[model samples]
Target: MKVLIVDDELNIREGLKKMITAFCPYVSEIGDTYGVQSGLEAIKKEQPDLVLLDVELEDGTGMDLLSSLDVIDFQLVFITAHNKYAIDAFKFSAIEFLLKPIDTDNLMHALDKAKKQIGNENLAEQLQILKQSLNAIRANDKKIVLKDINSIYFVKVSDIVRCESDGQYTQFHLSDSQKILISKSLKEYEKLLEPYGFIRPHHSHLINRHKIVRFDKTNGGTLLMETNCRIPVSHRKRAHILQVLDNQQ
Candidate 1:
């Protein structure tokens, strides 16, 4: 597959090109361009299968370059600095990103994921969600992109009833009774959802506080969800959960 590296920094472009050549055996050709306008021209001319794009450029931001495009058929892996807001935006959209200075293991993992998602039809939708998430001022206005093995779901944060841990996977229970199992760990989602009022009442469960129908004290402590599902509260978390509920009242 053909790959293009788009970044303003000469060292970054050169370093990434060298790494891709040394590590990515599937990549047949590698090209690069500096700044947004040049990046646009290179993409149109070369039609690369994958683009390792920097979040900022000399001429314009990476989002500007993407906005100028009429079609996006290539897989994208964003390169950004350690900015919390930008990382959260990427997470909300379920898009692949690498933090600078780049790590070899992370690059390879992102490339592997991109390879598996080469022909996915949800790229446009994911990009849209990314844009919205970046501009969102409130967590309620933000949407999460959940990609399962067979389908991608754009779900509102408010619509999530609960998230249950399944080994390395997290199963999302939606307000509409739809369950979507994602390949990420519950710990990952717990951090992302915590700011939006999601609580980890047990090691195996992340529950939306708004989705609680009732709290049952019997059988130690249990949460009765709006979906009528009973989720156990761990002994260690029982006091904290009760405190949170009391504070809410």
Candidate 2:
């Protein structure tokens, strides 16, 4: 896969290029550049599968590049010298990071993680992360867009109670006693929402782990939800469903 290495320092840009060549044999093309301006130009030109971005740059910050982009359609792995910004990476769902003076071992580890995660190349998801990165400084939770014919609503991930699959679309149960229709398949929602705590309990149902009230472990297992709707735990998910619930407590 193509990889773009973006950092302000010449040493790091060269160091990581060598590390990728030595460790990640799967990497086909490597593009290296310094500063956010050149990095953005490189990104627009190559459109690589993965981006190893530094937090700081000469012309501007990496976050600035994120802000200016219409959509980020690549897997992002951050390389930074500051520990303070590291904590915020999780909020934006950054794949991994490298500290100052890159270590070969850590670089390999981070590359492995990126290769596995982005191998599938879900372009919708790539755009979603770009949207998320732009919203990092906000105090509110992350959101996803649902377009119905008349209206488009951005629903917060945290406010989701559960998702029920209809014939052609999925319905989102929210905490505010409102139901919204997302014109997308349940499988699509499953892949998108899995990063959060949403899991498939039945063929037609995806439950939010944070909203579970109780579970009955009998042959016909039942799930009591915080919304007061008791859902059935499918036979296939019985063992894993209970295990996840146990771990949650």
Candidate 3:
């Protein structure tokens, strides 16, 4: 596959180019551009299969290039700094990103993900969803796209009542009493959903704070969700959870 690297920093572009050439055997050609305009030009000229883009460029941000692009047929993987807001935007959109001072393992992982999505039928729709989610900072204005082995679900963050860990998989309990079991671990969901008022009350459970009906102190603290599901709170996490709930109140 052909690849394009777009970043403002000279060393980053060169370093990434070297890494790709040395490690990524699947890549046939590698092209690079320093800023937004040149990156756009290179993309238009090369029409590469994948683009490794930087979020903040010299002239403009990567979002500018994404919005300005007339057609988007290639996969994208963003390179970003340790900016929480930008990370949140990426997370909500389910877009992949590599942090500053990039690691080879992470780069390889991101490239693999991008490669898998090269010929996705829903690529355009997913990009549109990403753009919308990035522009709207409010969690309520955003939607999450989840894919299981056989199906894809677009759901609001508010609709997720809780997530229960089932060994290597996570069972998502939604507002409509629907359960969707996904292959990702519960820890991944906890990080992604934490910004949207979801909390980990136990190692095996992540609950939406907005969906809590009551907290029972019967045989230890038990959380009653809006759906009437009772989730046990870990002894170690009980105080912290109670403090978080109190602060929210």
Candidates sorted on lDDT, descending: 1, 3, 2
Q: How accurate is candidate 2 locally (lDDT)?
A: 0.78
In model 2, pairs of residues that clash are none
Candidate 2 lDDT tens digits, 1-249: 899988888888887888899889999999999887888899999999999988788888877777678877787787777645444554445446777878888888888887777745554454455434433323136688878778888888778888999977999888897898877889999998876777788989998787898887776798888899978888888888987777555
lDDT tens per residue, model 3, 119-224? 7777666565556455434456568888899999998887889999999999999999999999999999898888677899999999988789899987879999
Q: What would the TM-score be for candidate 2 when compared with the true structure?
A: 0.48
Worst 10-residue stretch by lDDT in candidate 2?
A: 131-140
Write one digit per residue (lDDT tens) for candidate 1, span 1-249.
888999899999898888888898998999998889999999999999889999889999888999999999999999999468779989988999999999988988998889888878899988977875564434566799999989998999888999999999999999999999999999999989886778999999999887898999989989999999999999999999998788555
Q: Against the true structure, what is each candidate's TM-score?
A: 0.55, 0.48, 0.54
> By descending TM-score, how would the candidates be arranged?
1, 3, 2
Q: Which residue pairs clash in candidate 3?
A: none
Please give the lDDT score at residue 45 for candidate 3: 95
lDDT of 3 at 6: 96
lDDT of each: 0.89, 0.78, 0.86
Tell me how many clashing residue pairs each candidate has.
0, 0, 0
Q: CA lDDT of 102 in candidate 1? A: 91
The candidate, 1 or 2, that scores higher on TM-score is 1
